[model samples]
Target: MAPPQPKAVAKPAAAPAGGVQKAKLGKPRNYDLGNGVVRFSKTKMFHKKAKYKFVGKKNPKAEKAKKPTVVVKQIGGEKNGGTRTVLLRRRRSFYPTQDKITPRPHHKTFSKHVRRIRPNLTPGTVCILLAGRHAGKRVVLVGVLPSGLLLVTGPFVFNSCPLRRVPQRYVIGTSTSVDLGDFQLPAHLDDGYFKKNKKSAKRTVKRKTGEDIFATKKEKYVPSEQRKADQKLVDEAVIKAIGKRADKKTLRGYLKAAFGLRSSQFPHRLRF
Candidate 1:
């Protein structure tokens, strides 16, 4: 060999000004998280999984005491006349006990819950009316009615207060009582019996006229035959019952007369 020669090595080409730009290429096997779509992944593609510690709701069983405390209690009752010893497993809870507010009695049950009939008020007792169109009129109590009302009748022939219903609070009960003596009122009578029938609606709507809405009508409301029969039934029984009394005529006169106060006579001072 003549003379040793150095090996030539090729160097990288010089880049242009502002650096050379490379062609963009698509990334393979990569995807973004879907917004609640099918089989979506929470972690971003090629990203490390979050290292946050797992958290969950507290277990109710674990919150309870590990070992219940033994407690002694004394209970007394009619069956167990004396005190009895008992072992109770009392558990101390993590949360303090909270007091709850109680509510008042319900309105639905209030009516039935507070029902009480006056002992003084009884069937067939004579009472004096204190209110209504026939105020100061004396009537006989036929029977106890629904909703603590008194079913009374003025016998129609006397005070014109036909078989009617009045509240127990509106009348004063007298010592006088009527002896039905094997007589009883018809069972058909009830709260519904005293209710007036609703007027029938007109089939055709008539044109408006210049008549007063409350003007006096030519025809008057007449009691039906059934009402008349019921009235007669009640009155006849009452009349017959009165006739058997010792002071029948005096009692009739007292009922027929209207009650009123004289010049300075106090009603409270007078007895019924």
Candidate 2:
């Protein structure tokens, strides 16, 4: 090897007039204290004045927040018999207009939009439990995500199920009323059995005299007294149905139709 070459030494950063090296100089800048951390003396102590005021005299209201407006509701029957009235909230305006302004009428009807009630179900509607354990179970439909179809099911009834399992008959009907009407007894029994037959259909009467009775003799005969009794009952029922207590204004045409009544004959019956 030739004569050993001397390595160049690095120059130290310059110290400012304040006798402190500026942090802008790139280096592992540190200070030496005997054992504890070196406490750098600050040239200026920065402080801020509080913006909050305790006592305001001239504009005391400005310091306090504005009180919120409230509307109270009145509940009870109105002048029109049983008519109901409610107080709607009035919108506040920052500035008054030249003409006395009133709020526009709201015409929102529920029929316009179909509401989504369940998570696993689609946006339009859900199935109602008409009967059974899982009958009324509804699933929620989550917003469509790219990964897969998002179905929110159950928590209780929102639980997910295969779409193929949904039944067409289980859908909700638009009709307000499901008129099942009257329930009829089974056809196996005679009409007389339904009529106040205190005896059981399977039970047979045994005579203590050891005499056998034919079906014809066993059958009860309809006497004139029975006919008269039945007619009286029918007349009373008809009268009570069309009585004043069954006020036409508060009831539908049930009573009127039962008594073979027409709208022209009883105009008051059609008021409701």
Candidate 3:
């Protein structure tokens, strides 16, 4: 501007010997080579090296392995019948005495605080069925099965209940009972025997005549002759036993009294 000073010429910055530009002091830029290779800046390279170096080390204390105590107990049937020994490993003591080394203290038994009175379901006892198809029906207890099931019958003449095995929980026993001395049953009498007889009785009788004379005639099957006679005797005995407590006015009245049912809870009105 002052007397036409010589026009200053700007010269381009020259690259370094390695053909790469030196980064500024405060700012750095990354260089990209072909094939996904990137030359990181100096700060980035320092941070990457420091990330993989294991500077801080920790030594954890080793844990001790605990050994479990073994216990043996006798289980199953009698001495020589079906008994066997069982081995049990106990990681922790379950018994109160074993957990705490304390002297044996006398405490009130469970019966003192809470009394659990189970129904007396002996043989020849009169009980009311509480569940199943025979529910609300009065049946006489015949005997007990080996598996603790109760064998009962409705004598077919009364509630039409046949000989059946029922769970003890399904029947509510009463104080009335008959003399079971003459009503002894077989030790292995089960539902299978009655089912077999029932199936046999249902077999169709073949007519010898070739004529279809009675094509529409259907005959009813009788399961057991001797068992029917015995059932009648048991029915008589049960009626006599229940006579003391029940009113013999009518069959329904007798059943209602025997089962201790109220007017609202009558067996005929209640649905299963």
Candidate 4:
């Protein structure tokens, strides 16, 4: 095979002789001229708060006409409608107790309703942030908690919970209404940590067994009392084979004595 061909390099894009064109420049920059300070610029200054009166078409048809007041003639019907002649007169009444009056408490539960919100919250459900610095402010529910915590935004959630109770309302899935100016945050995520983590993950080696995952050693099987006794006998036989001074008959007698087993009469003197 011939020598491997070198990869072709990309040429840098050259600008025109006049230099690179710039993007559309927005309104001119503003300078806050403090006491004994003045700022001058070669470019024209633009007024941000400059009011412009829009002189456009004023459609006569679009103007709303005021409805004429209906003056009802007093044909004896005015007495029934008028509230001026109303009088408060007690007919018959008694003190109403719990038995006489049905007490209705305004108890509302947010089990299935109060949910986690993200991006933004819905407009309808009222919200009083149970946590964070914006805790007191009631806001309209603007988002759903697909995974965690409730989300509320706007002013309504504040008004609904006068006592600073649970946020409630209808779920209105609408467009996001996040005021960028009110609360500012980074426009994009920083992925330097993410890239480093990915490289570390690639170089990582997995455990051969589940036991390696834990710091402490796994528990081994322990024989019961009965099983231990049987194993002891087997161990004694093995030890005896290796020239140990182990006697099976003597071992049984020793076990019986250690276990407090006793006979009322001597075994040699006992009759059948």
Count: clashes, candidate 1: 0
Q: Candidate 1 residues 38-118, lDDT tens each?
A: 333446522434333324545566566656344445566767656554446333554547876788786675436554667
Q: Over the stretch 42-61, how does candidate 2's per-residue lDDT look in tens digits?
A: 32111122223433535545
User: How well does each candidate superpose onto the true structure, as a TM-score?
Assistant: 0.53, 0.13, 0.37, 0.14
Residue 64's lDDT in candidate 2: 75
Give the higher-TM-score candidate: 1 or 2.
Answer: 1
Clashing pairs in 3: none
Please give the CA lDDT of all the candidate structures: 0.76, 0.36, 0.65, 0.37
lDDT (Cα, 0-100) at 245 in candidate 3: 48
Over the full model, what C-alpha lDDT does candidate 4 score relative to the true structure? 0.37
Question: Clashing pairs in model 1?
Answer: none
Candidate 1 regions off by >4 Å? 1-114, 200-220
Instruction: Estimate candidate 1's alpha-carbon lDDT, on a 0 to 1 scale.
Output: 0.76
Q: What is the lDDT of residue 7 in candidate 1?
A: 83
lDDT accuracy of residue 83 in candidate 3: 41
Which one is best on lDDT? 1
Worst-scoring 10-residue span by lDDT in model 2: 172-181
- What would the per-residue lDDT of candidate 3 be over residues 1-272, giving only the tens digit for each residue? 55877978999789989999987676334556758777886668778677546557668889989654444454656664544544465336555555656788888864355422255877777778888877888877887765457888875666688777888778777665655556567544754555543233233445897856445543576667766765676567666655554444554344543344676787565532
Query: RMSD of candidate 1 to the true fold?
Result: 29.9
